[model samples]
Target: MQHRPIKTAVFPVAGQGTRFLPATKAVPKEMLPVVDKPLLQYAVDEALAAGIERLVFITARGKGAIDDHFDMASELVAGLKARGKTAELASLEGTCLEPGRITSIRQQEPAGLGHAVWCARHIVGADAFAVLLPDELLWNPARPALAAMHDAYRQMGGNIISVLEVTEAHTHRYGIVTPGRSDGLLTEVRGMVEKPQVGTAPSRLAAIGRYILQPEVMDVLAKGRRGAGGEIQLTDAMAELIGVQPFHALTFEGTRFDCGDKVGHLMANVALALERSDTGPALRDWLRSLEL
Candidate 1:
């Protein structure tokens, strides 16, 4: 059965990035830069690559900077054109989305992931849409994980979530998926447990940031039931749709960096820099020269 095309992608950027502390005090955590582009840009570009027609940012009061970052700076463009700076102008191309193609909704409160997603329900109205958490940066320029998940959604015609294996000890840190059957990278998600107590995890496979969810999920999220951490957990809402709808997880082939963590954020910068042609050689040499 063919499902509705996923044209809208929702980004939850309302969180207070307490983990980064002072740096995030004045800036949205999603604005944090890795290498060069902000974390949110990578997620936005990935969503656009997956054929998403519109972008919806679920934001909070202090997150206006996220909106400003995407707005076209006419003066900057004019300066570049006048100075004949084509390279610099080209860099901004990826940051620009056509007018009306992107919009934002105020989450109003720090409810939780489920609540954040529900904030965009009106825009996503009665359609299948993709959800991307910018903090989970997946490095795979050749084939973005979201694009791959979109491809699967076309054939499978149901909810598709991106997942990867975490260490057994780290299972408590993620939503553990219970597998019914598997073929290669795809697995039937029989059920899932959110932040399962250490040793009680059902499986080592943990759901990551990318998701292609149907409209019914918005209804589930609307209930605002709290779980795990006394917050509206999206995982619980997703679990409710399992047997009622087709649900599966794709074990994406790419390196993931939890940019929410300082160490992970630093690691992402180094990893991406070392892989770039313009920076790799020098960066690699410099890394080798380090005494650590």
Candidate 2:
């Protein structure tokens, strides 16, 4: 079951961040700062941490800012050098990726997550690929969640998706997995149901943002089979891979934040801030002083 190493990761950033509204009008939601760094940076860092070398971004119109954020800015670098703002200059290191390491594809239309992933077919070729959704941030886990998924991927070598337990009552809000035998964190994904009705879910485990999918998923998505929302749902395509292909859902090892939601975004910022030595002490004191 040897397969090409998961060297590349695809990011689907084509959806309009209507959830963020005016702020997203000019700034891509992916560009929204989680702390001082943009949300996308965290996702990129996770990919890099997990041994991902090349990044393929599926973007749409008005999302040029994503490229700009990663593009090396000569003037800014020179200014930081002249000013001797060592800390500030070093902070920019995460933002500028090496040239040619990133490939951006225009998604033309916001068909769905599956469509966005399908656009990267040629880029991914036949190798197994990783997909990280910027909206879902795995806020500073003890270790990289994707890295763990990569570990499981190398051993199991099918399709791996990171999942977390949601309350049984809240199962309708996420893509639920029909779980099979479990070995610690790894659970065999016998089946999947996207946003199932409240009482009809197969299990409490819901899919998260991290994924290691075979390239065949692109071909499945190419069928343009519309599911929920009349859009080509990635879950539906991934569901098509079960039984025939080995599918397992790995329970995430870290806390995940849905930055797509306003409260979750704020919580991520505060949580990350509270973990920083420079800000933690003061922030902790301030939080203690507050009367909730």
Candidate 3:
């Protein structure tokens, strides 16, 4: 039997993005544009393509602009109309969402990823909700990672997390899930260890920032203690749910960009730009001529 359809997704965007410094001083990191679109837009677009009917953002005090981005810009619309830019106007119209479709909850504290997700409990209620980390952008998949997990969730009938193989030496950077025998692309998760020591990790299949979690996780998050980095790590709560539920790790095929990091952000731009037919040749020529 297919599991319940995932109709809503939670995006955690409250953290103070200190890594980007002055750029993030006033502007939210989620608003940082990757090429032409902000990082958050890519995530929102991805979610929408994944059949997510509603979006719940866990935001803090300084995230008003994010809400505004999706709202229609009246003045811009007027100018586009005057210019007869029908295509651009239509794109903007498409971006405007019904107010009720999007909701926000205040995290109040910079607790952790777990806390951010927990804040959405009232909104998520008892349904299985997909979680998408706005900073992780995937490119050119027929569906986003969350959608892939949604498919896995439907088939597996349990909690599903997106997993990707990372360099074993860099395993500490993610929550690694130990794998058992795999049935096609989904692997049976024997256990998950967050940032395990190098060479001691059970598997290099680390959890990407995508999840299709049961509502029971909210209770676990409520009781979860502070873990790595002195924050309420979501991995801890997920770890607790492993044995209780049929947690599985899905190996999704796609190019994922870590837009959260400065270097990764640049890489996403380069990779995406090269894929655009109009810009590909020009960008290729420019890269070929660059003297390293």
Against the true structure, whose lDDT is highest? 1
CA shift of 147, model 2, Å: 0.6
In candidate 2, which residue pairs get closer than 3 Å at backbone N, Cα or C atoms, i.e. clash?
none
lDDT of 2 by residue, 1-292 (tens): 5656898999999989999999999999999998789999999999999999899999998899999999999999999999999999999986787788999999988888889999999999989999999999986456888999999998899999999999999899888999999999999999998889889999899998889999889889999999888888899999999998899999998889999999999999999999889888999999999999
Can you write out model 3's per-residue Cα lDDT over 1-292, one digit (the tens) per residue?
A: 3366688899999978888989998999999988777898888888888789899989998899888888878899999899999977766643678778888888999899999999999988878888999888877567677777777777888789988899989899999997887998899988888778778888889887888888889999998589988898898898888888888999878998888899999999899888878778999999999996
lDDT by residue (tens digit), candidate 1, 1-292 = 4598899999999999999989999999999999888999999999888889999999998898899999998999999999999989998976878899999999888888999999999999988999999999987988999999988888788899999999999999998999989988889999999999989999999999889999999899988899988999999999999999999999999899999999999999999998889889999999899999
* Candidate 3 worst ten-residue window by lDDT: 87-96
Order by TM-score, highest first: 1, 2, 3
In model 2, the runs with Cα more than 4 Å from the true position are none
Residue 34 alpha-carbon offset, candidate 3, angstroms: 1.4
**Residue pairs in clash, model 3:** none
Error of 3 at 205 (Å): 0.5
Report the number of the highest-TM-score candidate. Answer: 1
Model 3 residue runs over 4 Å out of place are none
